[model samples]
Target: MNRKTLALSAVIGLLAPVLAGCGGSDGGSDGGEAIVVGTTDQYVATEDGPAPLDPAFAYDTGSWNVLRQTIQTLMHVPRGGGAPVPEAASKCGFTDRENESYRCTLREGLKFSGGDPVTVEDVKYSIQRVLDIKDPSGISGLLSNIDTMETNGDYEIVFHLKAPDATFPYKLSTPPAGIVSQKLYEPNKLRDGFEVNGSGPYSFKAEVKGDTVVKAIFTKNPDYKGDLKLRNSKVELRPFKDADDMGKALDSGDIDVMTRAMTPEQVHSMVDNPKEGVQLTEMPGLEIRYLGFDTEAPTAKEKAVRQAMAYTIDRGKLITKVYGGMAEPLYSLIPSSVATHTNSFFNKYGDANPAKAAKLLEEAGITTPVKLTLNYTTDHYGEATAKEFETIREQLNGSRLFDVSIKGAEWSVFRPKQTKREYAVYGMGWFPDFPDPDTYIGPFLDKDNFLNTPYNNPTLRNQLIPQSRREADRSAASKTFAKIQDIIAEDVPVLPLWQGKQYVAARDDITGVEWAVNSSAELLLWELRKGTGTGS
Candidate 1:
């Protein structure tokens, strides 16, 4: 997800003001108490007043965690993961052999939380607004393939693509395609504040403190019509300032489950010394961290300099030192979990050879101790980010070929500068929007890529990406993806650092923890319940 800049446009003054409500009791569904989930993910409002909870504007995981519960997409990734399934739509598929034209029929009797009927016009409006506003922080890039959208008899919506895109159905499963009420939301403007009108399994009332969302109380949406079955009737989401605070809340019983932003130390503690009445669930994850370069910057502008740095940094040591072995060394933008993954970086640079690094600098006729500035966000990723960058600095400096300086800022400050290409080099993390290998590779390399960097490879962007997207069978596109990875390694626009594993710490009574999060890292809050475990 792109955690870039929030739009600063003035509020349109059309939508209703924020709504307030009391927390629910646990005695509503299956004899369970209200499930309280703790997270360190923060959602802040723009200075002009729109909050990230709006599906058209939210591009961060924090906002999506809440939106997925309230906003119903036409298609959704299944509980475990494979292919996209119909959610608001009765069925969906590409209509043409070229994989260009796509169509979906809305489910019968679908209604929003307020009992408004979900019509094809609402679906068309919801998607059109995202493209029209085109918030720099939003996921509009995922929908760039759409040439036009058409409605048929108020029940079906058809999409015409500029080119073949087999992944369009997967993109529709994301929050950017979430259907909103046309009567409630503006046609061309964002709905300010945290109030959401959606057709998902649950409806929420948010409590905001200034820009931050302090708490959100969610109760079952009685008018909801969807595929998911609500395991619990009531749920509460509490956002903390940090992992320590979130962990403390979990320990004190203020929250029954803790998921995102847990520190490596906290994870290890829970694994080694089990807390009473708590259990840990570990799952394979597609989340990845990497270092990106501003290709037009003075020092990093040199290709050899970028390659040398890549050769000198050891992923094994960095993961061991900072992540405490909680992460695995990543060799390509696509994580190993994907079928198309390749160890292109390892093949090109090998295992952190200082000699190779020095030789590249000498061959380029560059003097020793190349001065460079590396930027990172202090708050977005976690506290461990500082140590991760520090370890990187030491590794590069120890090679005697470069002198690196690190700068830190909060996400609000850091993302704007990074997008403006102010930093020569910066750190970034990715939680794929979908489970496809294309999600891992496309967002960084597409012409309208999320990174907003000057780095561009025409062969990769124009030829390979489109070539792969044309193939309906993803496995048939593996060779093309491997070629794309080879080009990425050769260009060195970004350096893959590590891939993380997903972990959730929760009380033993919390059932369905294993299925609580989908393959794309979206919180499936409806899957969680207060009962004996129904998952492995």
Candidate 2:
């Protein structure tokens, strides 16, 4: 179930602004060819699925995939990754040193595909509506710092913050703040039906459906204004139930691109064994997999018991035996790729030490063979999750200090229940909303984290977090981040398990595979195109 997730947005001052769609090949001159993309059902968006298409309500990757292309955000994590850049905004800057007031001017002549003019009012409505609707699973929490938004004339929008927040701009670059045409959407409720009215590189054309969505067709938005260029006139998004089917689709040329949820075994079969007209591209290791311990749960409430679990599990074995080395062991909440990430856990525990685990349990007055149940989402993570959890069960039981039982819950039920403190110990995966180190640190430590664990240290919740945000220099913020990681290592609120590598299998004739995955590890279908020649 553990795989890399999605990207986030940002603002403070427009740092390193790149013209959207400025550079990169237009997936080889259109040619009116339709690119068929293959993805597992886990990534396909449906009205009946976990998320709704309304920009304000969609939170999962399936929804994000549709939203990112259809709707333009004020800011974006550039295709190649760096500081957040203005995407829809012609210009943006902070008005105060405390990082409270922010302003943005929309690019002139912005218009939705439906021919509605995009105005500051639409931008203001998009931000305010998210706070108003506040879907429990939505990104409203990211906007908690905003006090109010005011629009001036037709193109200017200003945001007033309740508190100083440097990362507020980054949040602006995500889907939660995607500009929606006020004429097409209601302020207090999610938009009904599949019709999308947006001003991005693509527009919703039609959907091919059966019991579930078989294919979603997107055509280029002729009026779209940005740095992106559509490589093909149309994009056909096809959803498969399994990775094996996705791989087979790519091999048979039924699809031009194969996206997320491909298992390691399926990847090896395509890359190692060789598919005549297929190519596999591996992405940066930016995603994390971790185990959360609910502090309210009896066994987990004991610091010694939590520490013992951290000390006993072998992450190396999980990476090698289970993932086949597609991932690397992680020791801190922030993956090593992030600037402030430190292997604090590894520094303390070294490796799986049975003696240390037993000693810690004895000190806590907890007996050996601690019985506990571990939970994981069956549908959200991937098919490999069951094996992954079984490996965890075996590892803990092998320690002789824990008697572990594994359980599965559907994501629809699992996520809300976990947030409600229903699970004692569980596994979860994180995809960054933005590429900042703070994205990793802040959310998990927030008073109401996803698991809503009862561990809250003032040093982390109040002081370090806000202090890190106030420090304008990211490098200066890292010192506070390092300290927090040290604290998390001691607290054992969650144990970092593994960092994942992105995988994309594409037909050899696809020319833009290199640029298909932007800096944020997002698949840009607009960057893909069909080449005239076949297999090499």
Candidate 3:
């Protein structure tokens, strides 16, 4: 399950003070000008199930950003974890007498973009449908304990879990839990050709497909009652493929913002010093990059081999050289910003010591020149990934305990192979599905776990995951998770390499932008302005 996957509010100070308050600014939209932004289409079109524009079907972050705005959830994370705000629901929670049951009542006047009055049936069906999909998207596994789901009223729905699950609210806060209009989802795919029938502040428009994909427009959902924190009426998402193109776009004034997916060099050059019209800000990301050992492979299953290799590698050099200091070296599965992140692993495996590495191999009953292959995807993270591998190879071989061979695959191809467990060892990067330690640990929860890696920890998978999810309180859940991570560092099925940083550049005109802990590059579209709107 090791797929290799935030903040408090991260802040960025610009060289220029917050743009001056302009008259009739309407979110500082350059005074009545349309605010256009760009990003790349990372996924190419595929015939596979008509491409899951339905967030319920897949939990990719790019998709989550759109879905969270489109659908309604029963309970949500409030501004200060306030009482769950009503959407389709007036308010929802479990009955005191029955801790396992969850319930929500609807708000009035809410309608899907298609104008279907959101109802309890729609909520039940939308949730139940995920189990039917069985790919489970990301929420399926989390929802497995549902013993029953029924609508108590037209606007109210109840879920009876097989066990007490406190994290359920946080789970609902996640986009996959965003309720879909049963009216929009047909049998297996979307009702229309992937166009979202959203209920949020925006509606989907044109989509341009290419190396650099751009979505036409999404204006405020006129019926939006959920969160009006956003300041703009429209949003444009265009992919620049990589940072170089984004940098160029920022420079040429073709795009107003450069956000997300910048490499080390690009970060140094464009983030703070991009061409005119662009403003750059860098923040630590809710992302982590790591190395996974295919325990499914017989040779990799040996704990000694896994441990020895882990001990032998030079992570510091890789971060410094390959990542260009854009990344922070990580010593544990959980990252720095996340609660419960511990340096226990670092306490065990200090900076790379070739002598210690060789000794570890020798003690593990392995002779020098232990040969192995490591795999990575080309163009997935940055140009330096391959170079990172090269640095790793040098470090391992420097210890004279391992002979390393490196291989590269394009992400589209690499994704399937990793899912199939074809590589012996590989580089994996994960963007958190939900901004929680659970999302990080949940993917690699156990083999056949979420990401489908074969690295199963019977104790953690069967015992820990259920144990955590079933807790009556998330604080209690975090307690169990602390022990679970101790187990992770002890086992070392995957090695945590580095924590990534997210960088974004916006048009001086863009506003209402705030950085969440997860590094979502989140913008409440309605919060953006030109001459007539307000960003924050």
- lDDT for each of the candidates? 0.82, 0.76, 0.64
lDDT of 3 by residue, 445-517 (tens): 6433455666677889778877876755455576677778778777788888888776666666554433321
Clashes counted in candidate 1 amount to 3
Q: Least lDDT summed over 10 consecutive residues: which range in candidate 2? A: 10-19
Which should have the higher lDDT, number 1 or number 2?
1
Q: Can you write out model 2's per-residue Cα lDDT over 379-420, one digit (the tens) per residue?
A: 665678889999999999999999999999866567777766
Candidate 2, 143: how far from true, in Å?
A: 1.4
- How would you encode candidate 1's per-residue C-alpha lDDT over 310-420 as one tens digit per residue? 899999999999997579999999887676888999999987999998998899899989998889999888889999999999999998888999999977678767776
For residue 407, what is the lDDT in candidate 2?
A: 97
- Candidate 3 Cα errors over 4 Å, as ranges: 1-33, 47-52, 78-87, 97-99, 136-139, 187-193, 210-216, 271-275, 366-368, 446-448, 470-479, 515-524, 531-536
Instruction: Summing lDDT over every window of 10 consecutive residues in candidate 3, give the lowest-scoring window.
Output: 13-22
**What is the C-alpha local distance difference test score of candidate 2?**
0.76
lDDT of 1 at 505: 81
Arranged by TM-score, best first: 1, 2, 3
Q: Where in model 2 is the C-alpha error above 4 Å?
A: 1-22, 25-27, 41-51, 192-195, 205-211, 447-454, 532-536
List candidate 1 segments past 4 Å from native: 1-32, 48-50, 533-536
* Candidate number with greatest lDDT: 1
> How accurate locally is residue 457 in candidate 2, as Cα lDDT from 0 to 100?
89
lDDT of 3: 0.64
Error of 3 at 25 (Å): 13
